[model samples]
Target: MILKIGKLFIAAVIFTGISALAVSAFAASGPALFRSEGCIACHTIDGHGGSVGPNLSHIGSQRSLSWIKTQIVTPGAHFASGSTVTINGKSYMAIMPNHKNMPASDVNTIAQYLESLK
Candidate 1:
């Protein structure tokens, strides 16, 4: 009985460790996706990207996670394409491409990353 319990505890510990590592890895993927996914071409983050879109250095404070996700997956839901939209007192044309076909995992991770800016 003692050996069985010990083995169970060991398995639980290993499972927990693996879960933690996976969560951390998923969380870390957000930043890399932000860059590799071409977000930098139109959005500025921490003063390091283009000026076409809103500065996202503090987007978390202004937008909810769900809203960010919608903006990423279907920006047209928020603003029509080629229409002028005002954000943070700045005017910008709603030219952001839709990512409706992007993997849901990538969309979630990118939204999670942007939501963490606060």
Candidate 2:
């Protein structure tokens, strides 16, 4: 009985450690992936990035996680009519380019990060 209890405790500890590591890795990757994927070229996080796209400092407050994910994965599908994205003080009629080629995992990571901004 003692041995079984010890084994269970060890298993729980291992599971917790793995979970923590996974969360840490995703947290680290989210911002890095956003930058490496060139999102900064068009979007701003806190008025510090490019002005080609809309400022995304409060995007999480305006969008849901699933919506953000869909936008990332199939940007054209959502903006077929070519909506206008205002940057700084200028509005440009443009369609967000499709990122369907990006891996699903990376998309999800980015979505999660964006969702956390609120």
Global fold similarity of model 2 (TM-score): 0.69
* 86-118: candidate 2 lDDT, tens digit per residue: 545678667567788998889998999999887
Model 1 TM = 0.78
lDDT of each: 0.93, 0.82
Candidates in order, TM-scores: namely 0.78, 0.69
Instruction: Indicate which candidate wins on TM-score.
Output: 1
Candidate 1: tens digits of C-alpha lDDT, residues 56-112: 999999999999999999999999999999999999999999998989989999999
Q: Which ranges of candidate 2 are over 4 A from the true structure?
A: 1-28, 81-90
Best by lDDT: 1
Q: List candidate 1 stretches off by more than 4 Å.
A: 1-28
